[model samples]
Target: MLIGDVARRSGVSTRMLRHYDALGLVRPTGRTVGGYREYSAEDVRRIFHVESLRSLGLSLKQIARALEDPAFTPSELVSDLIRWTEDRLEREQELLGRLRTVDASAPTGWQDVLRIVELLQGLASTSAARRQQAVLAQAEGVPVPAELLAGAVLSESDPNVAGALRWALARAGGDGVAALTAGLRSEELDVRRRAVGALARMPEAPGAAAALADALGDPDPTVRRHAALALGGRGVTAAVPTLVAMVVEGSHDVDAAEVLGTLSQDPDTEDRITTALADELAAPTADSATRIRLTQALVELPGTTAQEVLRRLAHDEDRAVALVASAFLGLIREQPPEDGHDERP
Candidate 1:
């Protein structure tokens, strides 16, 4: 293609083409005998790339280096572009947040411009405030006051919504219990589990124990697990006998044991877990991960049982168990001069 055609196709002016040639930014293929520049198809491609970088807010000098660098791989250049975009976005968000603050304080005449500026500012922000705003908005079921929720993060909520629900369940009386019972009959397992567990937490919930027993028949493992746990947490003696039976024969033996163990301060769960672990260890085969988990759980228990097991596992023939036990023991020990027990065999 000729220089005129290249300029027309690339949208670069003729003067800029000459300047690019001078700067070695983009050059023509060759010159005719009359000395007029001629650009081949490759020249047109180069002009569009330079134009794209300029659109990204890259300086002419930076774009020149990027275009000229021989060692720059496509992936490396793309990664650099991503980092540049993220940095630009962060700066933009900070400006937007400031603009939001400014907008709330602006006089009537400046309000329209401030709104436009705030809208534009997010192009640079991290979008963190937007996430916080959405979460707060969800919690309130309405728009959260930006001034009060400013800089509030996702960590400020969630993970605790269910916990607060439990508190409500703990205090609700007859009518609340009835509503929760109806929730379990609803098709949604999430609604069922959340309501049931909260209902079971209250000491005086009407038929809560019966509702929970029915939930134990629910196909969902989570609903069964939470129901059993809530009953255990409340130490409702009515469920302990059933839990003891499950500890012996149910597929959810471990889940039941775990709930019981957590409720150990109020009920006798450790003995049941100990017996189950002993039975599992007696079997010719057990999943190694399960054994590992059981070992760690036992080690966490205080008193003679934990200490004796720690001593046994500390020198076990299995390399993984021995290494873990040795590492744990080393943390609370003092080196015995040059001959401490840490010495290699």
Candidate 2:
């Protein structure tokens, strides 16, 4: 086969075949009457082999060694190719993600695109300060896409940057809820925690409450606690059990108690919240410290049941718990009853 026939058959262009010949990668072993380059069957086969290796991201120099060097083993080279391809793929994926994010923002012009790209780069910067600055810039009229903020918030490890990202997401309104909701299902514990935390800050965001409610059942105790607290503050009674557990476990017990207090303000949840606390206090597993925390939590609740629970606790077995409960009971008595219900014991 001549060069043109070889190029046509092998899909390697004639110019590329000539370049290969120049580089001594694949030299045709025959000549025609006009002294034009001619390829033997084996030469054509070698051309196909070179093209095959090229498709695997091998440079021409590496291809030359692969084809001609008898001492060259492919195992290490193939491994290297695999790693290189993986790296390239990762870069391409990141670029594709950035492009998608920019597109989602619906930039009005080249300047908007440039600004969005710069902001994205800032968010992805290794420096936490840069990431924070990027997040804060959104508040200055950058019009950052919510999904971008949601993505940044999920991966941010820096507490300061994470807070800024959450604030930006909240400012962006409910649009970021979907991305944060998807983050709730992430297998990574930190991601789930971050997602719940961001969602917690956006209580008024549509679907944010439901996402937090779902997080209440998360396997991670931190995630569940955050979710429970957020939902409790939103007056979601579903957080009652977790809030009671928080008091019993002494994990964010004070904050949990406060939310429970707020939740109990509603007449419908007052009994349920107070009952959950009283039951935890009565549990045999309740230690002195746990009992004390529970007593303090009960003080945050309104209604006669909580007051009665506190009065009973004032004479409990644990001296420390009894002291705390007695003090709370005195305060409860001095205060007026809530909503015309007599809290006096």
Candidate 3:
């Protein structure tokens, strides 16, 4: 076959076939009387081979080495190609994500697109200060898309930058709840913690609330505690068990107690919260320190049941716990009763 016929059949352009010949990658096996390049059957087969390697992302140089070098090993070269392809795929995925984020921002013009790109770059910057500035700049009327803030909130490690990102998400309202919710399911413990934290700061929306409710069962105690506090403050009685656990574990016990107290203000949940605390106190595993913390937590609650629990603790076997409980009872007695219900007997 002549070079034209070879090009036509192989789909390799004639110019490219000539370049391959110049590079000795694939040379014509013969020549016609007019001195035009002519390809034998074997030469055309080599041409097909070169095109096949090119399809595998092999550079012309690599293809040359692969086809001509007797000492060349394909294992290492194939492995390298795999790594290179993976890297290319990762970069393309990141670019695609950025483009999606920009499109989701619904930019009105080129300026909006530029600003969104700049902000995204800043968020991904290595400097925590730059990331923080990017987040704070949203307050200047840039109107950052909530999903962008949600993404930043999940990945941010620096405390200050993370706080700023959470704040941005909160101010953006509940739009980012779905993204943050996805973060809750991340295998990374830190990402799940950040997701719940950001969700805690979000407005009292059903999606945010539902996500928090789901987070209450997180394997990490920190995640569960944060979710419990946030949900407790929102009057979600579902957080009662975790909040009570926080009291027993002495993890953020004070905040947990305050939220429990607030939750107990609801007549329906008041007995449930008080009983949970009372049961922990009566648990055989309740050590002196745990008992004392539980006693202090009981003081945050209203109604006669908590007062009755405190009264029982006033005479406890542990001298320190007894004294602490006694002190709390004295304070409770000095205070007036709630809602005209007198406990002044």
Q: Write the per-residue lDDT of candidate 3 for residues 1-44, one digit (tens) a residue.
A: 88899988999999999999999999998899999999999998
In model 1, the clashing pairs are 89-124, 92-124, 92-125, 93-124, 93-125
**Candidate with best TM-score:** 3
After the best TM-score superposition of candidate 3, give how far the Cα of residue 214 lies from its true spot, in angstroms: 1.6
lDDT (Cα, 0-100) at 304 in candidate 2: 73
Q: For candidate 2, what is the lDDT?
A: 0.89
lDDT of 2 at 159: 97
lDDT of 2 by residue, 50-137 (tens): 8889888889999999877899999999999899889999999999999998998898899889888889889879999998987777
Over 1-345, each residue of candidate 1 has an lDDT whose tens digit, in order, gives 677877787888988888888988888889988888988777788888889988876767777888888775557666777898999899898777666655643435665454434433432245546433333233232222233121221112333444543443343244355556667776876677666656556635667777787776777766666666667666654455445445444446566555555644432455554545545544556455444555554443333444456567677666676677666556434434345465322
What is the Cα-based lDDT of residue 175 in candidate 3?
A: 81
Go through the candidates in order and give the clash count of each: 5, 0, 0
Best by lDDT: 3
Q: Estimate each model's TM-score.
A: 0.37, 0.92, 0.95
TM-score winner, 1 or 3: 3
